[model samples]
Target: MGLFSKDIKTMDDLFVHQLRDVYYAERQILASLPKMIDKATSPTLKQGLESHRLETETHVKRLEQVFEMHGAEAKAIKCPAINGILEEADDIVGDVDDKQVLDAAIVAAAQAVEHYEIARYGTLIAWAKELGRADCAAVLEQTLREEKAADDKLSAVALGEINRKAA
Candidate 1:
């Protein structure tokens, strides 16, 4: 169902829809990270992406837990926003020839994904709280903090060396 589709008739429905949306996005990112890791030339960047890949696995499971906690079937709906972002990332990464520049591109792309996730998780937490599901919100909050840390790590890698080396 579309975001504004009539299928969503209440706040709970909206929350579950969004949960499925981010669930799909997280799965997509989990699949895409290996490609990004392979494309990355920097050891630090590769290791970081690899670590986040494993973390993303936990995220998917956590989302499943949230689904179970809410008594909703765990399923993923296609998230066009994440698809577009990943497509654009693939295009840009493929276009770059320089290794350093490519590493920079990867960091930028990864950060874009992270930022998208942060927004989704943050919203999910708020909605979970609104729905009186503090348990679900607390679980989502862990993912949000991890997403933010991943973003910050990307920023550090970019500023600490990647961008300068690319330049």
Candidate 2:
């Protein structure tokens, strides 16, 4: 359903809708990571992407658990925001010729994804608590910390080496 659809008549409904949104986003990130990993020329970047791919798997599972805990169906709705971000990443990565530059592009793309996720998870956590589901918030908080860490690692990789080599 669209964000403004009458189907979300209450805060709880809104929370569930956002939950599904992030669910779809996390799955998309999971699918896209392998390609990013392969495209990365830097060993540190590649290893970080791979490691986060594993974490992304756990993120999906945790989202499912949150769904069950919140008594909502464990399903995903189309998240256009994530789709657009991933598509833009692909476009940018494909346009770059230099492998080192491509690694930098990949890091930038991955950071975009991480930033998107961080926003979604942060909002979800707040909504969960507002809905009196601190349990769900707590679960989502774990993923938020991971997402933030992933973003930080991407920044470190970019500033420390990738951007320099690309330059």
Candidate 3:
């Protein structure tokens, strides 16, 4: 069911829906990251993306655990927001001819994804707590921390060298 659909009648329903949303988004990122890794001109950015891609795999498994704890099978709903972000990244990469500038663009695109994940996981943690699912909250909190770390790393790579090199 779509967001705000009749299928979502309680906070728990809302939480599950969002969880599914991010689940799908993470899967999409998994599919898209290899291309980003290949396109990246900076060693640091490529390495960071590779690491995050591995982490994303763990995240998907954790999400599956969460679903099992909640008495549901792991499933995904479409997340157009993430699709849009990934598409924008592809467009930016396609348009850029300079490797250095492309590296900067890749960093920016990655940060966009991290920011989206941060928002989703942060909210999921809060909702899990409100729903009295401390177990889920703790697990989601771990993912949230990882997302933040990933974002910070992207920022550092961007400001430390990529941006300057692009300029």
Candidate 4:
């Protein structure tokens, strides 16, 4: 439902559509991460967010390469799923007054984002392989690995200290 609708009659069109969806999601994350970093109280959380931001920038570049390889111009279709997640995160974080709790909330929000990216990349990689674009699949698998690592990092941080500190 992004800039195009009902016209995706082929797997290639579906693949390209998803690529645009993730591209939009990544850009939204790039904008949202700075705010998450600023609101984070824990040094570790802030550092993690910063590191992820850099990784996200790299993800964007990789996505661009994928688009180029596929012969499509890199474009973003509005991703309402990511938009809703980000909005919900802002609402939840804004409601918290405790710094420790806020840090935990940030981790939760970040994990949500990571999970979303992982799902998207996973599907995209499978589709790439199905379409015989091993190159695209390889690139996407790298991003999926990074997303899972980031999710695991967030979980560890939350479970090891952030949530307990909040309580």
Best by TM-score: 1
lDDT of each structure? 0.98, 0.96, 0.94, 0.95
How close to the true structure is residue 113 of candidate 2, measured as C-alpha lDDT?
Answer: 96
The true-versus-predicted C-alpha distance at residue 101 of model 1, in Å, is 0.3
lDDT of 3 by residue, 71-133 (tens): 776999999999999999999989999999999999989999999999999999999999999
Candidates 1 and 4 compared: the better one by lDDT is: 1
Task: Report residue 62 deviation for candidate 1 (angstroms).
Answer: 0.1
Candidate numbers sorted by TM-score from highest down: 1, 2, 3, 4
True lDDT of residue 23, candidate 4: 100
The candidate scoring highest on lDDT is: 1
Better of 2 and 3 by TM-score: 2
Q: Model 4: per-residue lDDT, tens digit, 1-167?
A: 74357878889999999999999999999999999999999998899999999999999999999999999889998999999999999999999999999999999899999999999999999999999999999999999999999999898889888999999
Q: What TM-score does candidate 4 get on C-alpha atoms?
A: 0.97
Displacement of the residue 73 alpha carbon in candidate 3, Å: 1.9
Evaluated at residue 124, the lDDT of candidate 1 is 93
Query: Which runs in model 1 stand beyond 4 Å of their true positions?
Result: none
What is candidate 2's lDDT per residue for 1-167, written digit by digit as tens?
99999899999999999999999999999999999998888999999999999999999999999999999999999999999999999999999999999999999999999999999999999999899999999999999999999999999999999999999
Off by over 4 Å in 3: none
lDDT of 3 at 123: 95
